[model samples]
Target: MEPAEMTSLRAALAESDFAKPPRINLRGEPIPDGLTTAVVYQGHEVVTDGSKPLRGLDRVIGGS
Candidate 1:
């Protein structure tokens, strides 16, 4: 994800009541999951300026 997207997400997570680091699965792999509604930017669909983006490695380019 881009830095700007991340910055916005951080702000929203900070305001949330249940924001927390994700836990790992039994195989020692971190489960990918997030909570938050998101709004897609008009010019860039991949770009979201939503209150919550539920960001993770899965959302980042090359992170896959």
Candidate 2:
């Protein structure tokens, strides 16, 4: 991606409610401080606890 696109993407994510990803992993375990996880579902990155869709992820990722 271009720098401008990356900047826009970062700005969008920063302004999103799911910017702070879930604390637990897919296994439902407590994530340690300073650590994070990336979960992909149906070819899209989602902020879930193995159940719910991200609060604002659909807008960010343009998923239906």
Candidate 3:
């Protein structure tokens, strides 16, 4: 994919809401500090535990 296309894909994906990932507590549970934390995006629990971003907005949304 072209550089521009790739960039767009990442943005959309980043904005998407998702379900709770592994080792996550959504019941007002408190998580320890710096304990191999997971990445939370738009109320979505990303199991990848990474906030580096996955895909661009357009591509992630299956547009271009």
Model 1, 1-64: lDDT tens digits are 6998878665554443222323221323333572333323322223222232334522442223
Comparison by TM-score, 1 against 3, better one: 3
True-vs-predicted CA distance for residue 48, candidate 2, Å: 6.4
Clashing pairs in 1: none
- Stronger candidate by TM-score (2 vs 3): 2
Relative to the true structure, candidate 1 reaches a TM of: 0.28
Candidate 2 backbone collisions, by pair:
none
- 3-53: candidate 3 lDDT, tens digit per residue: 987676566665653442243423344445523334445565443323334
Stretches of candidate 2 off by over 4 Å are 19-55
User: Each prediction's TM-score against the native?
Assistant: 0.28, 0.39, 0.31
Over 4 Å off, model 1: 19-64
Report the C-alpha displacement of residue 34, candidate 3, in angstroms: 44
lDDT of 2 by residue, 1-64 (tens): 8898867766666556443565343546754553343545334454443344555553456522
Alpha-carbon local distance difference test for all models? 0.36, 0.51, 0.44
lDDT of 3: 0.44
Stretch of 10 with least lDDT, candidate 1:
17-26
